[model samples]
Target: MTDAAPAIAAAGLRKSFGALEATRAVSLAVPPGGRHAIIGPNGAGKTTLFNLLSGALRPDQGQVLLGGVDVTREGPDGRARRGLARSFQRNSLFAEMTVAAALMTASAIADGGSAVFWRRFDRDAARAEAAAAIAARVGLADRLEELSGNLAYGAQRQLEIGLALATRPAVLLLDEPTAGMSPEETRAMQDLLAGLPRAITILVIEHDMDVVFDLAERVTVLDYGAVLLEGTPAEIRSSDLVRRRYLGERTQ
Candidate 1:
């Protein structure tokens, strides 16, 4: 990985589900430390593009590069090992575990520690401390002992992000971190994401225009499985094509 390389890039990525082409020649490059967002209406292929980039699905064409190294062939775990981490829109949690325990487990796995069922997690003081720090970072420090399944919807989302952070990713891909949150929760999540270290590049797929406009330095608009436009937030907001295709505006 060179200093000048993009944190993540896709070149001519294409995917088809049988007869339907999901992503049509989609391509993007997110520079190191860049904050970017992908937005579109329903069925715009945003999820398919994310799957290809995260190695959840292989692209029918083109390549996925992480830190400029081609990773098209790598699976999700392999990409994770290479400093790419992703958070899903739905909750992925250990329902039976405490918030601290869940983060500790994720951190331990990321550090190559095997799960030894016979041992207590807290016995590993460093891992516990790391988990606590992650809990703090994600705004769950005060809820470390709470059962993960019992957390409020917003806190669960925060913990989901904490799980991703445990991997210490160089590039983080978030799938609608603010989804399903109240306005207050959304604002809190936004601030938490905004406060993340600039050393980590972020690429998010979001439907909330407020979050998109506020959090993303650059935005990519997708329509009908292809990029409608890619530009700064100001450019994207003011784009006549974007307005017509995505924002539901009629031409004068």
Candidate 2:
């Protein structure tokens, strides 16, 4: 594990949609290269919190810190430039484009080159370099010609992650990456996520406790938009509050 300071920090974060409060002065930190999990019930403000982190939605108060910089007011692109990136749960991708094309597009953005438009991909050396590296890293090398939409659901999710990785983000925020996946696919995703380069930090919000405990070095439990408890997997599994509030006890 990396010993550097947190790659991302949310201090006293708050958000609201009119009278409904989505996030209630929440604060959390993911140390550099840490495998952190944000576990919460539905509507516990997980998605809302993700929006705040990625600059998709501005917070009502507090600040977001990335690489020890206060970027509370920066927009999405600005955050991306600072090595902050994210992947959506809803499968964000270009359905019509082949995997190679999609990856090459990411390569363009990463290499800071012009995007391909109405032309075949012949030899954008820089983009090809980045695309080939990312595709190989994500195990999509063979599926390069497959259209994104034509791939299996798990493959689509893999592409989504591959896109995020193209930026070479120092910290990656994943919003329920395992949602709708079968057991086999879920395990595969877990393995892929776990094997990520140690230089990249990961903060994930997931429902599968097994996956959470398996991947996260530390876990934070939230209920009603407030943090309930935080600790290692062993500590959280034995916490009374976690058992009562989040994991219902099995009746005798």
Candidate 3:
């Protein structure tokens, strides 16, 4: 591996809740501008791991590094300020707000101008332009005027992604972006994600094998809160350990 610092790295990470060990000495590295994925069966601590990386939860042990800086002590807002952003598995949009309004809010927050109540967001040319640009990037330009809650499920998910991009993050953590979707919708989401600018490093936790294979350059399999295996997509597909432990006969 090159000596360049990773965009995100978890070193000997561990976390627990009461007696439950949700993460156990987990470690992984994501190269700058790379597409990496975490996959496993339910209860494999994928979400918990995401929480640690995004600073939603502090690890009991180990360190989280973003762009080579130790951010283990940073909170979610702190991480975001350092160009780390995350999208949840559920729709977290403002249901009553229009897509434009929501995106403007996100852009303003990320730009550290949320306190500028003296000027209307829509009237701010720079913020409005940035919001419109992000909306187009995520394929939500057509729905700009629609109420976020009234959009189709797939559209809602698109909005979620748009919000994440609005932060102009250097590292984005996406959890189950396609959790529930029709085949057509899934394909659309896949295309949208695939088209994202490679300047932004993407780390995704997804259950769909097809999606994982289609999007990730590297795959990390987790089991019982620890990394079971890590390899290229081809290596992961061919590994007997992964097949037997996770992918099953279908991968064979």
Output the number of the lDDT-best candidate: 3
Local distance difference test values of all predictions, in order: 0.87, 0.83, 0.88
Better of 2 and 3 by TM-score: 3
Taking the tens digit of each residue's C-alpha lDDT, what string does model 1 give over 1-252?
636989999999999999999999998999999999999988999989989999999999999999889999999989999999897333444667788888887777787875454146657788789889989999999999999989999998998999889879999999888888999999989988888889899999998888888989999998889998999999998988898788764223
Worst 10 residues of 2 by lDDT: 113-122
Residue-level error in angstroms, candidate 3, position 162: 0.3
**How many residue pairs clash in all the candidates, one count each?**
0, 0, 0
TM-score of 3: 0.94
| Model 3 lowest lDDT segment of ten | 88-97
Question: Which of 1 and 3 is the better model by lDDT?
Answer: 3
Please report how far candidate 2 places residue 222 from its true position, in Å: 1.4
**Which should have the higher lDDT, number 2 or number 3?**
3
Model 2: per-residue Cα lDDT over 1-252, one tens digit each: 956567999988899999988899989899888999998889999988888999999999989999779999899889989999897332334677777777776655655655555134436667667777777776687888888889898878888898888778899999999899999889878888877898999999999888899999999887888788989999999998898888773322
Query: lDDT value for candidate 2?
Result: 0.83
* Runs in model 3 lying further than 4 Å from the true structure: 88-93, 115-119, 249-252
User: Which wins on lDDT, candidate 1 or candidate 2?
Assistant: 1
> For every candidate structure, what is the RMSD over all alpha carbons to the true structure, in angstroms?
2.5, 2.7, 2.2
